[model samples]
Target: MRLARQRAHALIAKSPADAVRSVFDLMENLPEVERLRPSEVGLVLVRGRVGGEGERFNLGELPVARAALRIPEGPVGVGYVAGRNRDHAELAALADAMVQADVWRDRLEEGVLAPLAAGLAERKADTGRKAAATKVDFFTMVRTRGEK
Candidate 1:
């Protein structure tokens, strides 16, 4: 089985509140908005695959926040994110709508997604560095009598 994957909007949806809010704050002419589905928190069943692509199993339930909203004059957007941050979810949905609009798409990409993506990349690099710092490598060598 295959799963559909998306990056940009997912990044936005999962971004920290402060990060998302900074982008939201930059918008000059946000259209009037309405909630198609109010932001809400719930639990979603997490599934895992054994050995990555082997048998699948239920991992557990995880908290998720989701929101669906629309610009009254334009596109609809949806957001789903891990954790229980309703505000983050709403902001993500708003960004999604903005990204879909021709007017806001470029601005959203430049002012919002670009910086968010850069920050995310930096964060990943920092995490990798931290993990590398703690990484331990082990090896065993057979003693040859001749060499000894």
Candidate 2:
């Protein structure tokens, strides 16, 4: 039997809050908004968090959101968002666009393009330790059964 596969990619800002907010906005204005999911869709609140200043403020808190949407057999889904934390709208939109397979020309403009671009410049100036860890290489040898 042949297998069908769908791929989705979301280039989110370094912040998850931003991702959440954009998703919520899309869900709220589904009808008026361009490149959004339909009304009959549903979404699941996967995760949430709140923190600042190197302190554990709140983690895994299920913030109240507006709606969730899933397209039938379309490999695209969206979640409407709202609440006190109204931050990650742009990231959310980008993520939704990726999952929906709808790539808008203005994705970067509407999403992490500007913020991340500026952030990249700022990071260049700072001498902080690199946030990401480098990969360590490891190799294994396999021997085939042969006349030794």
Candidate 3:
């Protein structure tokens, strides 16, 4: 996934004007890719700043967007987006990693990784809520006969 994201990012950084479309296009053509449900994806708009040794500038924030891609028969969603700034490549790699991982379906690649990659702190606290609830405890519980 990281490789995929990097690919996406490089594609975008090389062509900022068509970054978003390029990402969507690549995902759309990926083999066996499953399109995420519309309700499963979320987006957030944010503002931030970039500070240098001599000056701090307000980098106007655009909507940092994300989409969920459902993996086949897997209880995971891949979150992704083409974000603002020159870190498009890094964000793409992070998104790809999240998507390929098993435990990160609910994660927002666009909101978190994008901003972090761009060297800005996240301005919003809204993480997307899960549409469905599931519980899985990795720890094993031991029981004695009398405990029942």
Candidate 4:
């Protein structure tokens, strides 16, 4: 589920405003979710794990937009997204909330999560391909003199 949340976060953050608006517009039977903590912008101290295994270190502060929403069904979903896009934050919280529900969980996964994750992966692959285009390979060949 963490992956789902991360996927939703990435997708919502990168997607155009119109695309997000369209998703919300076409969404049906969405539970009434009210913001418990209204979307707000703040700075969070970024932490890093060196080499993915070393002790954590405070990297720097990053500006983030966060919101929390409570659905009457059960869970209180929180959205923590990079950048100050309030609408994206709200939509993330909404997706989180939807993912919690039994009825809409699969729908949310299929409709939003899957396609967005694929697009994100595709974008990453394209970036890698573009980068690979300029990559240079270096090799050392053993040379034998007349004695050899």
Q: Which stretches of candidate 2 lie above 4 Å from their native place? A: 1-83, 87-91, 102-111, 114-148
Q: How many residue pairs clash in each candidate?
A: 0, 14, 2, 0
Q: Give the better candidate number (3 or 4) by TM-score.
A: 4
| Per-prediction TM-score to the true structure, in the order listed | 0.85, 0.29, 0.30, 0.78
Deviating ranges (above 4 Å) for candidate 1: 1-5, 146-148
Q: How well is each residue in 70-110 modelled by candidate 1, as lDDT tens digits? A: 98657887888889989888878877777777777778777
Summarize candidate 2's per-residue lDDT along 18-51 as a digit string, tens digits. 4434444544323223435333322344443344
lDDT score, residue 9, model 2?
18
lDDT of 4 at 51: 88
Positional deviation of residue 2's Cα in model 1 after best superposition, in angstroms? 18
* lDDT of each residue in 1-148, candidate 3, tens digit only: 5564554344333344344334434442232435444322233544454543555555544544443444443533333444543234333434454556555423434533343434321212222233223445588789988886
The 0-to-1 C-alpha lDDT of every candidate, in the order given, reads 0.80, 0.38, 0.41, 0.78
Candidate 4 lDDT over residue span 31-138, tens digit each: 888789679999999899978898999999998888899888887787777878887778888887777777777888777767666766787899999999999999
**Candidates sorted on TM-score, descending:** 1, 4, 3, 2
Q: 1 or 2, which is superior by TM-score? A: 1
TM-score of 3: 0.30
By lDDT, rank the candidates, best first: 1, 4, 3, 2
